[model samples]
Target: MLKLFSLSSSLSILFLASAHAESQVQLSHVPSQSQVEDFNEPRGASKGVEARPILVIASELIKYFEGWYPSAYDDPAAYCTIGYGHLIALQACASIDLGEFARPLSKGAGAALLEKDTRTARIAVQRYVKVDLSDEQFSALASFTFNVGKEKFADSTLLELVNDGDFDAAANQFGRWIKAKGKVLPGLKDRRACEAALFRGNLQSGKNSTFDRSDCAGLGVASGAGPVIDIFVGE
Candidate 1:
């Protein structure tokens, strides 16, 4: 009887151990659809969905512009410096569904740009654009304003009307840049069209998108095949 009882006890222990292992294995199965969705969302939503990493997107966008296009990297007042930075700002308008700021220039202003300062241009962008953009938008706009100045863009009918909520008309107005100094300038026309396209939210030019997780170095910002920045304090 003792031997039989001992064997029964041993068998019970093994059964319990096997059951526990099976339970643990079941618990470790693939995450549910909702769980996966929640994990993938940008930081800042409710439970499950992580908040969006807009700022990181903005940061990477700005960095991309700086690295890829430097000619447009001037202070407010330069001209013909069109670069990736300008492209990012122009694209931000569309991402947020806002209007583009289109302004002509005077010859006297030439390359005497905005001195690489961000304060004035940022204020102008916020005031005139009427969209609450991320820091990347602001930074990109500041760069644009640095190159073109707020007055030039703000005073234009295209931007003014767009701010008034006429998107179709505003889009049509982009084509007006087909001429310069009483003559058609293919380059300026192309530039204007490109800017308008960006304002339409096409990231083909790589504006407003986050960098590769592997590319973001020392930013202390979370990244992976997952969201770019896990948190944003806002600016």
Candidate 2:
């Protein structure tokens, strides 16, 4: 009886060891560390692309559209804005303790605010876009979302078309959002045209690439104005 019990115990131990070996083999086939990192990144963050170039293009586009506001001032729609279109009252900037709403921001403060806003915008772009995009596409969308708020972008036909793989239609949708307070702002028109061109791959990189405002010349004004909010303002 003792011998028989020992044999049964040895068989059970062997079976457990075999199961452990099989699990290790299965785990070996699991996602790699890089894959896991890519999977875990927040929405709007790019994977398998160099982030610096995308960031540079996005920053340049945002700078061009938003301009630099070193001090908090009332935007056209009357929101307290600072830096590169960052609203002073945004929840994201709540902890930063920006003094008075009308106070002038230092260059360092402005740059820091712009960086944080850009990060937020980029994350929004990544989160809302359900399709795989090239770096340029992602950057252009990020720039667009930075100009238009995330809520608007999320509800926009542009995002719907892009997710549906209708690139052409999505590219054309940028022109439709040019109105601000029932007026077609020339700045927004030009910005949207540039963004559309970027989305279509018409604008190349390097020294030769230029954002031509002429493309928006004939596009008629849109009467339905969007909410009068500056970039990076939280809901």
Candidate 3:
């Protein structure tokens, strides 16, 4: 009877272990943090997306808007500008080791300066955005931040809309920023349209498909008109 009891006890233990294993197999696995985040993205945004490195294409697009000014010049806002809209005071430029102040910059030098300036924008964008973004989208936002400055971008309705995944609404918000110092500038209007097109994934070869030329018509404000620096400075 003792031997029979021992065998029965062993059999019961094995059955219990088997049942536990089966229950485990039937239970759903918990998702990881990354998985949960990806699942929560807006329908049109990419899934399992990672931050993209700044590519040449993005650099080119930004360069088209900033324009390369090797010599230190005053921007429309009166900021001492050099090497692709890099705002530095003449005094500050003279103190920096990066390049000579008031000297003609080479294309390579201008590109390098642009890369340095854009890094700040990229970092700001990464900090503000929680959802995953495509390379083009990231690039467009970075470019916008580069132009508008991180402080304004941080406080903007555009950034708010973008963070909430309302990209179309955010794209529309770009056009509202065309004014400078209480006046609507034609050059800014053109730039904002291009930026909007880029944000909406509607830009082709750096041109806006449905851009209304009527705003800057006959003003010679071509698409991607550089920086509008002259407007603010009255140069």
Candidate 4:
């Protein structure tokens, strides 16, 4: 359900006057898979603080928990056990946030953020506002990364499908995940469903690339705004 509107048409007069001064720009700073994994888990804590170790907790759950964990709320142990789960969530959040190189962390906005380099993550999120997507789609993409590492999303058919604008096929492919390494797992199947919903623009569904609010204030709406501003302002 991609909506077609012409904000540009409405603003054609403004655009024409601005078009001459505007210059096109391309983004080439692709994020690497290894870069995201480096932040996949929490690292050392203060020497004497004795803080909860989030990475250890999440890693343990992933290793020991058998088939279909079904989120923290569904697990009776998760409800009965407060402290350990909280610690795990903290670690998961931290690792996830760091995975995007410390960009904004929304509950279900993980997938899109993961493939971005740190410098571009913030800009991407802001630019995401202009894209048409459903809330579910938006949140699903975010949460997908929250579960599966961002690396998977980057190297996934999901990204290709999204960039290609094949929403329905992408949705169909979401349920295809059934294996962990070589073994088919039910948990991964469910997770893929969630991620697919995100990919198909089901969650947070809306139009994309509609808004071009400058990354900075007082800047004209144009490509290369950042670089242009930097050249003039010397950031």
Best by lDDT: 2
Tens-digit per-residue lDDT, 86-140, candidate 1 = 3213222224322322333232222112121233444556667774444443443
Between candidates 2 and 3, the one scoring higher on lDDT is 2
TM values, all candidates: 0.34, 0.59, 0.59, 0.34
Candidate 3: regions farther than 4 A off: 1-52, 55-57, 90-99, 206-235
All models: lDDT? 0.37, 0.60, 0.58, 0.33
On the 0 to 100 scale, the lDDT of residue 56 in model 4 is 21
- Cα RMSD (angstroms) for every candidate in the order listed: 24.9, 23.0, 25.8, 23.1
- Model 2 regions more than 4 Å off: 1-53, 90-109, 204-235
Candidate 2: tens digits of C-alpha lDDT, residues 67-168: 676766544434456766666542333345667644777866776766665555577677778899887788778777766666677878789889999887
Q: How many clashing residue pairs are found in candidate 2?
A: 3
Q: Kindly list the per-residue Cα lDDT of model 3 for residues 1-235, writing each as its tens digit.
A: 9999999999999999999876543221111112122234465353343434564545765665566677876544334667766656433443555456556778898887777656656777888888887766887788766666666677777788888998877766766655445456555666667666656665554243222334322232234422232221221
